[model samples]
Target chain A: MDRLLFGDNQFFGVNHMSEEKARAQSMKFQDLSAVIDVLDAAYDEGIHTFMCTTHDRVGEIVDYMRTKPERYAEQIFYPGMPYAHKYANAMTEDGMVGAIKRFLPDGGLLDAAFKGGMSVAKKDIEGITTLLIDAEMKMFQGLPTPVIFLQNVVVDLLLGLGFKDAFRIFAEHVRKKYNAEPGFISMNLPTLLKVLKEVGVENPVVCSNINKVGFRMSGGGVTAYEKALNEYEFQAIAMSVFASGAIPPREAIEWVCKLPNLKSIVFGASSRSNIHSTKVLVDEYWVG
Target chain B: MIRIGMVGLGKMGLSHYSMVNAHPDVEVVAVCDSSAYLLGLLNRYTGVETFNDMSKMLAQSNLDAVIISTPSVLHAQMVKTALEAGVNVFCEKPFSLNPSTSRDLTELARSKKLVTQVGYHYRFVGAFKEVKRLLDSGAIGKVSHILAEAYGPVVLKPKGSTWRSKKSEGGGSLYDYAAHPIDLVNWYLGVPSEVRGTILGQVFSRETDDEVFSTMVWPDETTAQLSVSWSDPSQRKMSTKITVFGSNGRITADRQECQTFLTDATAAPEGYVEGWNVRYTTDLTDEVYFYVRGEEYSAQLDAFVKRIESGEIEGQNSFGSATGADEVLAMMVADANRDYAGIAAGPAPQVDRGLFRRRTKS
Candidate 1:
């Protein structure tokens, strides 16, 4: 019997700078060789596939990955995106720091600084869109990258736009400019599938949570959130297997086993022990 | 307290570093490896001092013991060096590539009366501990037969002409991989009175077979089937498992994960032991007395320190802890060789996977 499809989900948020810096710093002692060694160990441990979110770093590795496709070909999965850029220089350091501080509880000066920092991050997302979009087009043509987008329930009240209003703009941009099919843009609600159904997402439809679902925390563990059984008619994804460390492997496997509607379950192992445990679950549940 | 030094800063060495350093009353202060790269890795990750030379590291560390986690071929030399330094030692599995070197290492440990331990972490897993406990308690009366299965993906990829790929360096799957379960079987049940197995290199392009299957017959007429493989595709990992068949009951242990469940048929409701309902109740985790038996790696180190302090290591086989591991590897290697030869000569090892299959119709 074929095992259930399993892949990891990794997307970059605005914390990209810090993450790159960390990797770059580590590369002083352990360069791409170090990363490759770890990746090889993972592959040897049976993690045959890795899903990299659309980001500049991912683009670099994907290019590296293409060169050694035999070693990495079956292993890397690319998810495309409509890049959102944020401008960092436009905001002063003190202004950014002040906003971050304001967002903090009790609104102290330090907390206001934290809020300011986050506002800059928000602004940065908007600024990166053009660069991200250009990279997305190049990636689609050159590689197996699948486009990914995001959908929220309501239109922008500030802009007085409906849901379709924003989507239509992006769709037109993709079609006229890139001349490529728009792939999956995850939606906040399954009901939004109605709008996407009209547009026809060529890529697979993935279902995640607007917030945490399931037990202890909302929409987290499978014990609490049953699969969206009523919405089973749509091709769906089961993401966030290890949303909380509290859900034991046995519980997760049992839940996934019961979900007949899911095309696949997405998860990953970050350590050797985790790989061992996940193998046990995969052998027991998916392989049977 | 046993003051110990460790060699090799690889994954296994790091594991030893953590285990030894974490032990109370033990000091793991000195580490060594020829690979400056690996030494830097261990130093950065473990914060232990490193030496490029094992001899210097041993002599200068002022330690009572050493753990050799270097390559397999280096195990014998390292163990001998530590023993000569009047240091008790703990060496990792595949004690040696061949029986002669293993025997020599064992003899040295015995003669020195040094506190030696072989790194066979599987023996400490709670699953087998429960199996031992249940059998001792007569929950599974008179263990008459046993079967062990081991397989993983490590064997399929060539160690690529490294020392691990050389027979002299213990490159074969049987030596490097099967040693764990083989040692476990030998520990749980005495050596097989008659051993035969089939080894297959059916996957990897190597001088040795990457997969193996064997059967052993105990003197008491009990039988065991041992299946070991390194050709699993998804991951180079394994689930070392065993099933003990006894007069009163049967137990299944997925030992690698430290999980086991058992059932006694003779003690069953209708004297029917073959079903799920007959499972004898016990917490497998609790049954493994590592926290009490003082058999944990740390506890083993503490014991060596005690021996050093008491001057009582004489006649004790310390570094020969791989005694069980070596024997298992030897047996698996022997069996695999015979199995492989037989296959190449047009006969295959006869196996019946269904023998253990439950009689569901009844």
Candidate 2:
């Protein structure tokens, strides 16, 4: 039976916590540890998936999994760079100039990485690769233990990266664009689906509500009853189920039940009241 | 007791039909529409007499007021006809295409001393009343910036004219969807000094613009930005949400349902409706009952009737006024005519890059 997954998506005291406290907490548990705690709580509460941000957390998450090799035996971190999810440390006031000097070397590290045959240590390559994998795996582990990377959006930004590095490129794209615009994290469903097919992943694309909200607010085609959302090729996490709140509870319930392959909804509410309203999915909707 | 007549048999019309039919101080004695099927539906739904022609229904029915739910363009003529025949009028919005027409209607109703109401229902929403209270009480201090968004696609008719595709019929996203926000912003800002807007045919390749965005400046030098569109592809009903920012706090309201917020730097308390009835009462005078005692429709209709009976034109005019709807349309039209470079040449702007961003480093 497909059940609705609901849980807090933000940290405790998100509203009440001071920015200093939040920053300190984020820094103290700067790596995968923070993500693990959240996922553990969410999983225990029946939340099967979660999203992760931060580079240090990536390494921390992978390191924790290393201690439990058996639990992560079958898992594979999709290979990619941390371009999209780059660490703030990489561009800090102190680090930016150094990075430009070290990587760019007058030309830039991005330019240098493409120029091959420069003698490189296996240790260095492995270390960089490990950090990259750790980041992706940390995000992965935030999902249910058996969670696999479901190529969610087509992320046009990920296009052209070779097959082996497609997933890594996808992550980089996310890191790069997540906040460049209001709905940057949202990828075109149809495009993402096509890329996922080419990448040969059978994992379902769980559509997010980030784009849907923006599109809906702009009076875009997001509301088309026949939009790509209703198409059979995709599965979705109705992120905006409580979108307008203008829709009667009964009507929203009926609408969700009619979807062809709707798996679950990723509620985006933050307030306690908003979180409570999430019960509309289980109570009023799937009660029958 | 005030006597009333009803027109149209759609959901809104039927709602009013029942509202008046069930009122103790009011009676829905006559009804009219162009559809016999609808007439039959109304007959089965209510005990009132129905007619195919409005004139016949108006001439024969012993009514002191008429509720119109016909298409927007027909509102003015029907309202004028009803008033000429000595009937008080309650009609729906898009308040006759432009401000001049709305003014003309208001003047005509005044001269005849007819009680008139134009349906801009959000005024009755609980959240809005609270927002008004906050603005009045200096809860948000001197309001400076306002942003309103109301965007959603048109629910297309199966085999009828898509009037929203034409400019002549007051058809377009600007006049259709923006009417609510225009009314809303104006209601909030009193009278804005200057209005500038952009209307475009973004998704719909039809004749009229499918999307429109506007920025209005109030007399107090406060500014408001509104975005409206009819290109939403989903079948979901969307609405206007207004966010007013001031020196001390911010207030946001879900325009249709009236869910609201007012917060200062320390902590923001959000209100929720609880208990058996789930009535959302505020820290204000207006109490919004989510589920009206099954008597709200009748209550509003009864109010309309009392306004006519009392000959209190000003009170009814203020409550059901369509004063700001057309000015928004006029601004939308003017903004649509502006060149992109022209707007860019004029001012320094604040741009919201959005909430999330990629981490560049550790």
Candidate 3:
């Protein structure tokens, strides 16, 4: 993984502090060309890792990137799966069977259907879980996806549901099938690391809110996160490092870069200057 | 009598079967379903020719029309095949999963001069129809804003087991439950020119959305808000309600009743006056030929059969209407996706209390 992973929240219009700014950013990036332009700026700044949700539009970006292989040769995509909105929209339009048919990897319909049916009949969570993973991974086929993530919504829900075994199922399948590391994003980093360890996942790459202000960091806030960082063997990717713009850029990056066990920081920006400045700051403060 | 072929013996299929079979001017000549058990049952009851394949049914049925109640993903292909086979089509909503496909089907139907209808039964509901009539008559002058809401308790759990929860097959509240109110919006006001502030989220369902909220603006400057939910426990099975605010007054309508309140004297249809007026669906004067779970279903079917028999190519509920509705649905979904990905600012600020007082005093 890169030391600094570029996040897609800016392109997608996700601002925790100001809904108005989010909407404005959303209107600005309605065009794919605009998104590509910003990404190019980030890439020019030497930040090649893009951590993104599997929104339907991201599929278009993937297709565009695939067309220009050399241009994006070193580009890495960290696709977060079961983009709940995509599935929700698909299910709304096509129904469950139709949605499955639409999203299932090409040439694996029967196998997936059998697996799905068997999973339903026999309570085979592994089969069902892997099948869904494959479905979500369909768009990333033929691309450079080094790390596939389970989105926070599902991760937190499974955590709440006490479905700890799913983490192992996801990790193993991602490694075995895609040959990629399976990453988990959650609001509660300490508990997730605990669950990942219980499921026998060693040195897992966990992404969560880690910043000066402890914005959205739950289950004991920054104190618990710091303890987890010191105690756990897993690599940590700090996100929301801006604390939803509550903290200054330098102070936030300065505080997060000094944290123990922190391997990467994922941040979103729309302009080249922001990207370049953030990159400079991270390089200056990062010990490694 | 118009000969009809029934396709897909699911819930909607059986409902259409009963309605078509009961209509005096229609004869259900054949039926098609993947399940032999359902085919056998229908054959035993209706004595109609049955086929396991749609192509076989289309070739041998000698039907004048086909009523398609299959999963929405199958609509484009089925409607295209039926229309190319020279049979009119009455497809269940939405017209197709994609707007382009829906447009293509509509073009084919138009080139063939076929009578077509998309099942937006709410349009046929007496209360809604009256609302439409009132709007058309300018009962509420210069409409400014509208709120269309459809809520039900269909998906309350983490069950992503069905096609309704999938996006590929057009399974979500946006397509299934929201399409009604969306179609109503398109019918009452033109298709929105701009859509923003969309929020499509899952409440309890694992994969698909149980709630959708969006803001749409028409070219006429009429802004509308659409909120559809399949996870609201407070709602009945399927409740569609709309409130229209115009310069003159406001009108609110659901399946059972239409209520109106006029602030000043305005021209309204007969039986409606200047003040508060409420009309129950039973008071509707337009006679529906048949009644089932809803008169709208029967009325839409009756209109389709009548148009086919009379060789009329276009009218309300035509392919054009369905295609228009499908386009608007596509826009709403697209905007919702954008909005979900788009940033959220805080809620728009409220009117200043001092300004409000000053304006009132003036």
User: Which of the numbered candidates is closest to the native, going by highest TM-score?
Assistant: 3
For model 2 chain B, where is the 10-residue window of minimal lDDT? B285-294
**True A-B contacts kept by model 3:** 0.03
Candidate 2 C-alpha lDDT tens digits along B1-362:
77778876443565565445544466677788765544543354334587888888889987888889766667777877887898888886677866777787788778888778876666555566667765766665678998987865452322213334556766666766778777777777776778765655556434666677778887678998877766664313444577788776666666323333334422222332121111132222121111112222333555666677778787532423676677667766776777778556877655555678543433
Best by lDDT: 3
- Model 3 local distance difference test score: 0.79
Residue-wise C-alpha lDDT for candidate 1, range B139-249, written one tens digit per residue: 667788787877765544543434445666666667666777777777777666667654545567467667667777777777777777767753313557778887666
Tell me the DockQ of each model, to 2 decimals: 0.02, 0.01, 0.02
lDDT of 3 at B1: 90
iRMSD computed for candidate 2 = 27.4
| CAPRI grade of model 2 | incorrect
Candidate 3 lDDT by residue in tens digits, A83-145:
765554455444544555566555364344444431232233456568789877888898888
Consecutive 10-residue window with the lowest summed lDDT within model 2 chain A: A178-187
Question: Which docking class does model 3 fall in?
Answer: incorrect
- Steric overlap count per candidate: 52, 30, 36
Candidate 1 wrong stretches, greater than 4 Å: A1-288, B40-47, B158-161, B200-202, B256-283, B286-321, B331-362
Candidate 1 or 3, higher lDDT? 3
lDDT digits (tens) for residues B1-362 of candidate 3: 99998888665676677667657798788888775544543454335788888889888878899999887888998898899999899999999878888878888998998999889888887788888998998888889999999987677667555567777777788888888898999889977888887777889866567788988887777899999898876442477889999887999987766889876645788777888987765455243433334556767888888898889998777778887778877786787656342245756656556744643432
